[model samples]
Target: MNAAETPRRGHCSDFEAPVYRNRWRSLALALTGSLLALVPAAPTAGEIYRCARQDGGAPLYTDTRCDAQAQPVPSRTPPTIAANPAPDLAARHDQRLQREHERRQALDARWLAEHHRAAALDQRIRQAVVEGRVVAGMSAAQVRQAWGAPDQVIPQVGDGAPRERWVYRGDRDGTGTRSVQLEGNRVVGSGRRAPEAPSTPPRTTPPR
Candidate 1:
């Protein structure tokens, strides 16, 4: 109303404006706090490294020491071994063995045929000995036809009825020696000697 009253009113308005400003500041702080709670916080920085440049100027960021260059480490993987892809060697070996077996069988057959022929010839010789009737006073040629060749022939040293001795050794399993006494070229006597024990043991005959 008066000049003095205007000054007092101005001072009161100033005081009220400060109170409103303080309240507005408090509301703004509360709103800022709510916004911060809703947003997610940023993650903290991990370990950092600094690598110096080769020219010795600025340093570069790396995950290793500054003195060493960064390089990928080699993985600890085992070496792979390739498998052998050879052809069927076992089958080929078996086939070769079969061929060998067949060849041996053929050889055995031929040998068996030869052995049978020899056996037949031996049988004929034995039959001839039985038919000839080898007796005393027979010629040496007749005795040979009866008993085949003698194993040994020894001349007589002193005077006697017989002038020579013809010896026939026994077979592998047979015992004793068959001998013929000869007067000149004729057979004077024929006999067998008693067998002595063999130096080596006799072999066992296989069963037929």
Candidate 2:
């Protein structure tokens, strides 16, 4: 056969076929990438914008912004109703008053209960003082047993701790009365007040 009709020795169709197939693969890959870039992405939960035209047509809602004034709108959600017209002023005022009255009643009940308790405690302590049975550094249980109930119990605040001061008098003056101070439900001290020292004039040499 003539050389022109025979296949070349050094050049084979197998090599050319592989190169041609490779070029086709690269072209296919480029086309696929371009198509992916042009495609839109999945829709997000971002707010949709509503645009109004100068001609007063129906508003247009779009994900893309418009040259006109754009207002935000929900994509799939229903429009929300207003907050019930804020309960007319009179109704609001009445509701507020009712709440305030309820709060005040709760406070009053609590305060009255506390006052009654204080009065009862004071009575117990006064009875104990009359009997003269309680002493200093006595536990609450011991005091309750020996001193009896107090005339009244008044809470005291001192030194970042709660204290109880048993202070009262059997007479108009504080004579024959004892003062007791309690902390942590235990009597810390108890005693009568000391008498004040009498004032006296200083001795002076007589003027000659």
Candidate 3:
């Protein structure tokens, strides 16, 4: 073989072929790895705030409320995931709705408790006032226990028999009024009347 051809064949060895191929492959892999590192990471959840009561003080997010003077801080821990992925969306929504339902139930229970207490106090106060007014020929004290106190009372005086008028009002968001009229100390007549709502006063123009 010619001298140049002989040298070329020696240089083109099996070891040389693999070394060149591996060098290019290594460079390609390193470039890909560098690009992946440059990519940004996913975002996370944010903060929340809470307070003891509105107008009580500035709000904050803590298991416990701060002092009246101290403003609330951003003290609550953020949720683990900012949004629900497809697989978890339904479960997350159900959890949120359950929490809402529980919150509503708690609020309703508190409202009902307060309403019951107020109603009991009002009944007691009315009974004291009515008991002092009972007289002969009038409905006995038993009536008072059965029915609430009179909203309107008309005193009576005359021969034959004296008379009294007792009016009972109902609660219907001011839409209706119910009255039970007691005459001569006994329940005589009862009726319901549509409430005459007060007309709204005309608004006056502000002085120029």
Candidate that scores best on TM-score? 1
Tens digit of per-residue lDDT, candidate 2, span 8-102: 87775765888988899999999999999987554345867777877999988777656444545755767987776555889889999999999
**Model 2, 193: alpha-carbon shift in Å?**
28
lDDT value, residue 54 of candidate 1: 90
Taken over the whole model, the C-alpha lDDT of each candidate is 0.75, 0.72, 0.62
Ranking by lDDT: 1, 2, 3
TM-score for each model = 0.30, 0.29, 0.25
Pick the lDDT winner: 1
How far residue 93's Cα lies from its native spot in candidate 2, in Å, is 1.3
Give the count of colliding residue pairs in each prediction. Answer: 0, 15, 3
Query: lDDT of model 2 at residue 13?
Result: 78
Candidate 1 at residue 3, lDDT?
Answer: 81
Error of 1 at 128 (Å): 9.0
Stretch of 10 with least lDDT, candidate 1 = 66-75
- Candidates 1 and 2 compared: the better one by lDDT is 1
* Better candidate by lDDT, 1 or 3: 1
